[model samples]
Target: VLRLYHAKNVYYRIMRQNVLLLERKPEIPPSKRAHTGKVAVGESNQRWCFDGFEFSCDNGEKLRVTFTLDCCDREAIDWAASTGGYDNSTVQDVMLRSVEKRFGDRLPDTPVQWLTDNGSAYTAHETRKFARELNLEPCTTAVSSPQSNGMAERFVKTMKEYYIAFMPKPEVRTALRNLAAAFTHHNENHPHS
Candidate 1:
């Protein structure tokens, strides 16, 4: 028994050494951690956060999902899914729909700060123009830091846990339909903690 324990310890020590040797250090130094800035605190409709998440269908087709959330109430303002890929157009469509649904035809008297990551779509010239036209102040999170937009990130995680995880893997169309219904229920009925 003593010999067996010694052999096991030696094996584990060698494996630990190998893992340490194989580990690659991060490009950014520990002291240079990404800063996400302060969380927004205001009335409903004043600040909104948005982000994108991706999942794969059973057939291996990728689906991109974008979601916007009201920071005040923690309500999901709007969301969109595209198999074709989320681009500047998709971002515009989602933002426009959200604004129209919440504020109707007329633009808001005060500019709404729409917070998002430094994604290509959010940073695009066309998207910036559209936001300006609709009285939206595009607020971007610090580069490489998603925690700055914690509300949107939490919503995405909740969505996957409550809806997407239980979905039938083989049916993309059905999953999408279910997702729409789930989103509505989540936004309208689900209470935030």
Candidate 2:
């Protein structure tokens, strides 16, 4: 096994050297913006970050879960699961649910800033229009910079660690049920200290 491993490493090294000698370096595009560091949340519900997380079930089916987090309290404001893929319609649904959860049926007089990554669904024109109608100021993080939307990213990581990672993998439905329970637990019971 050791001899085979050494032989494989040497072969890959030689192949990499040959490839590098023959291929020219590709040009890279300049980043759209610089890193602006963490976003400060002045108060609860002032700014919300939304993102999509993907998980796989035991049977190899994939599910995309969309969720919104309140920046000030790190609470899971709202979430939705879909096996049909996330698009403008799903994004709109999550936003509407979040708005309703916060302000009931009436829209807030002050628009809340909705921070998210530059996903196609979030960037779609219809989604933008709907957000405006709901009194939300849609804001996208810098291109190629997930850290700009770190709060949501962090919550996704925590969810995977504490909940999704331990879920039984037999069925996507079971995973979804567990995920919903985990989200509720994190929002209502998990301490943020």
Candidate 3:
């Protein structure tokens, strides 16, 4: 229609002007951003990462799991599993449970880095605000770069290879029960070397 009316250039100019009106993301400071290949920490609670994964049951139902891990000790601090899709609320629950497990109902005296991928749940405004409220500094991995959260990525791989691959997947309820045991076993018996 623009070309037919000899207004193609006008349309282009209008689009160019309107482009600047699009929403822009605020700049995240360097210290609050997750750097690639920098997932390690010298001590527990200094940095923690969380990620989600999903697998199918024998009945073809999908079970999604989200987990929090300490960067220093490589411990699975807390985790949640569900047949439902992952969302901000699920991530928030894991964050609260992890904080409670580590600090015993008290928020961390220092802000701990909460590293995660740029998932909607992790990057949600509410989630980031909640993290700050809990004394956590939220940091997201670089876009399209999972290696920036390598520790959590490796943990997910380990869970899939060592635990999930061998476990019976009769149903979601049974799988959740087994996954809990797997997390416990990983924390207690798995070597962190």
Most accurate candidate by TM-score: 3
lDDT of 3 by residue, 1-193 (tens): 7576678677767877889455678876555344556889999999999999999999999998999999999999998888887899999999999999999979999999999998999999999999999999998887757787999989989999999999987999889888998899999996556
In model 2, the number of clashes is 1
Model 3 regions more than 4 Å off: 1-36
At residue 139, give the lDDT of candidate 2.
Answer: 86
Candidate 2 lDDT, 90-182, residue by residue in tens: 899999999999999999789898888989999999999999999999888877677889988888889888888987767887888888889
Give Cα-based local distance difference scores for all models. Answer: 0.81, 0.85, 0.89
Give model 1's clash tally. 0
Ranking by TM-score: 3, 2, 1
Give RMSD (Å) of candidate 2 vs. truth. Answer: 7.2
Q: Residue 114 CA error for candidate 1 (Å)?
A: 0.8
Clashing pairs in 1: none
Q: Model 1: what TM-score?
A: 0.78
Q: Could you tell me how far off, in angstroms, the CA of residue 70 lies in candidate 1 after the best superposition?
A: 0.8
Query: Judged by lDDT against the true structure, how good is candidate 1?
Result: 0.81
